[model samples]
Target: MSFFKAIRIDQRAETCDARYVDMAEEELMPGDVDLAVTHSAINYKDGLAVTGKGAVVRRFPMIPGVDLAGRVTRSTHPDFSAGDLVVATGCGVGEAHYGGFAERARLSGDWLVKLPGTLTPARAMTVGTAGLTAMFCLLALERHGLAPTDGPAVVSGASGGVGSFAVALLAAAGWRVAAITGHPAEADYLTSLGAAEILAREAFAQPGKPLQSQRFAAGVDTVGGVTLANILAQTQFDGAVAATGNVGGMDLPASVAPFILRGVALLGVESVRPRIALRRAAWARIATDLDAALIDAMCEVIPFDQALERARAIVTGKIRGRVVIEMP
Candidate 1:
């Protein structure tokens, strides 16, 4: 058939570069279904992949996008058919395989989740990997016996996509939200998303005692390193912290005092390789619990060509909430 434009990353003389080029459908990876991509969203991982900032890409000349939503154009899988709406996130889409960020995609039917009745293609991407990560974090907290009535839950890195979604989801679930942010100007924005309190990054990012005064009953931490250590230090007895992102740093300088003395739980949330059952459950919860109006207010729609710009913004913490790319 005809060639289509796709963003590709190439390696030359030990250096990596990203560019958009016209490619044939035959270049796509083997999969059971072919999709006419409608929308995709930028994630922190996507930023790393596109910018070559982290070890996000394992091969040269790759397409980078962690999440996509669209209609099926062809399928070998019995459960999926032409014209069926589908969403796929994680499952190594952008990292180990050629992914979205193109007009068409080939993906395993097993990786696909049919869009719920409550969500359209655009809205599905609006809740992309970031929102799904938020859901996974919240689910982790819930599994650890954290309840809304327990007390306030802190959301670290509150201005970013996952953090913003965490704040809104926790609030909607009837938990008081304490937003921790470096951008003081986003306090009002955090408040609008249902954060009851805004804590400055300076107040929390500093190195602190191994054990500090208990604060949150639970927490969803997107910033790792000392930020996670501090959250662990201050979490209430028997409280749980879902640790997701490592934007702050990967090394966690922490003491065992919290876990040994207070019984605090450190739950690691990895959305990329989550079990199919957990992925389905997380999406179901998101479909029912997320506030659509609030999500709309928090999301920014961008043309597909601007995905790179949006990815850079996401990596630099310049973008608020989610950035959805309209593909067609």
Candidate 2:
């Protein structure tokens, strides 16, 4: 087709507006490889962009989707070829670029990762950027020499997409996972994902001491601010915490005692710009490390038209796991 369906976000005055529109192939951003996007997924950053709640969309009149899985229809890049399945996340998609909300995508071949043999396009989107990030956190802890034998692991914001995947990935890797959530009612859901303990969010809501009791060996913290501060304070000596999202707040109301005294490490995960090799390695591991059944269970697939509505739920913390978008 000369034109494809896409969700376009444009700024009208001070407000941001997102709508479904027909976009010509010429309107796609410049790139060497062209793909017929079969699937995409929502992320917290996407929610902010779609709803205009945060400064996620740097360019106006842009398509907004951070993750996509599809097949190459044309390519000049050596690493990809026509009819090859591929997946892409981050690298500025949904922000400065046209992104994958469209039925077609023209993206840098460097930004694409060939889908692992075990992962289907739809399943890849189920894992999406959130799951990739979750795996990155685990890899960080592994590089730091922390193992399941180290001690119990804790994940803050356990009900969200990244946090939920973190819980499952950690558990599957044999870590004793303690999930921390604001929604007390999701305890059962968290447990089903392999959490060994369920902690209330209130426990970390307030400002905590510079160094508190060593309750966790390592942590995957999605919520920043007081929650991250508390996780750092409570981490065991020589333990590390990989932090990604800042949904709680950007300001870190914390002290250096955890680092100086306990030797705790705070690893900042940036999924948007990871090295291509690392991205490939992480995706490869995810395909094997995680059970396909669990991955299927962790996401809810929706039609492309419902993307914005789901985006609102994600930003407001109403989504339980991942939200996969099926392209029409």
Candidate 3:
């Protein structure tokens, strides 16, 4: 087993395509830890990078998986040793660095986090970057005084990987959840995850009014721009909204009314390049906070060969929940 397979993305004449290819361990980018990846997860950003739809890949000839779970085969770093289960996410992996699209990944030891025995490599990929982002959103809102007693938390983009996790975790934590989605047909699915109510994305996507009737006490928003603006406009006084994505649009198009009149707070949540302590804490929480059944229900395991097609589907909103790519 000297060589392994990976989905390699290369650019030529302003175009790019991701394809499965055989790769040697020695061909990996410089790093201290060598891992045999068991699973990798596709994210919206990875979709953009793999499909060349957005400027997600600054360098050509990259591996386009942002999150992975595996076992350490070799490590010089003091914190790790042979046969340790681990997971790696964020920190520009699958982007500025060659990442987990490969069955083999040589990564900076600094980026590796040991997975607790309670977590399996496959389950770790189910959480991946999207789950971590969802946890960060929950924590941010919590810090800003979000509690189940305040009101139901709203999750925009409810069918997304992050959104789905948010719904399940919040429910497990005893918070009433309202899932807002463009796909109304997913109401039953979201309800099963503990959403007390479901709102149509059409109504939720409308332009902001500076201030609107109070709705969610706290919210995790994966859809930005107008959707974010509206959430802020309607968030309860002193409530918080953690904004994590710009899928709808980039412009905020909002005002100070919500900030001043309502005293609502909008927290920016970024998982990539997060402080080491926060990252570790979030992963530890995910290991316990996420319901195992929900994780299993939301996760779909696919062969590494399907990475390209899955990546395209992710950014196009065709994917529901998380997509994990099993290494060959």
Judging by TM-score against the true structure, name the best candidate: 2
Q: Candidate 1 has what TM-score?
A: 0.94
* Residue 89 displacement in candidate 2 (angstroms): 0.9
lDDT of 3 by residue, 1-328 (tens): 4778888899988799788888887788898899998999888889899888988887879987889889899999888999999899998899889888888999888888999778888889998888888888988888887799998899999888789888887887789998999888898999988899999998877785889999889999999989999999989989889999888998998999999998999999998884777878888888888778877888899988787888888877788777888987
Ranking, lDDT, top scorer first: 2, 1, 3
Local distance difference test values of all predictions, in order: 0.88, 0.92, 0.87
Per-prediction TM-score to the true structure, in the order listed: 0.94, 0.95, 0.94
Clashing pairs in 2: none
> What ranking emerges by TM-score with the best candidate at the front?
2, 3, 1
Whole-model lDDT for model 2 versus the true structure? 0.92
Q: Which sections of candidate 3 miss by over 4 Å? A: 315-317
Higher-scoring candidate on lDDT, 1 or 2: 2
Q: What is the C-alpha RMSD of each candidate to the true structure, in Å?
A: 1.8, 1.6, 1.7
Residue-wise C-alpha lDDT for candidate 2, range 1-328, written one tens digit per residue: 4999999999999999898899899989999999999999988788899889989998888999999999999999999999999999999988998887889999999999999999999899999988899999999999999999989999999988889999999999999999999888999889998999999999999998999999999999999999999999999999999999897999999998999999999999879894899999999999998899988888789999898789778888777677889998
Q: Candidate 2 clash total?
A: 0
lDDT for each residue of candidate 1 in 1-328, tens digit (9 for 90 to 100): 8677778888778666887788899999889999988998888788888877889988877888889999999999988999899999989898888887888899999899888788888888888888889999999999888998887899999988889989988998999999999999998999998999999998878899999999989999999999999999999989999999998999999999999999999999988874878888887888888878876886789998898778867778676677889984
- Name model 1 segments beyond 4 Å from true: 312-318
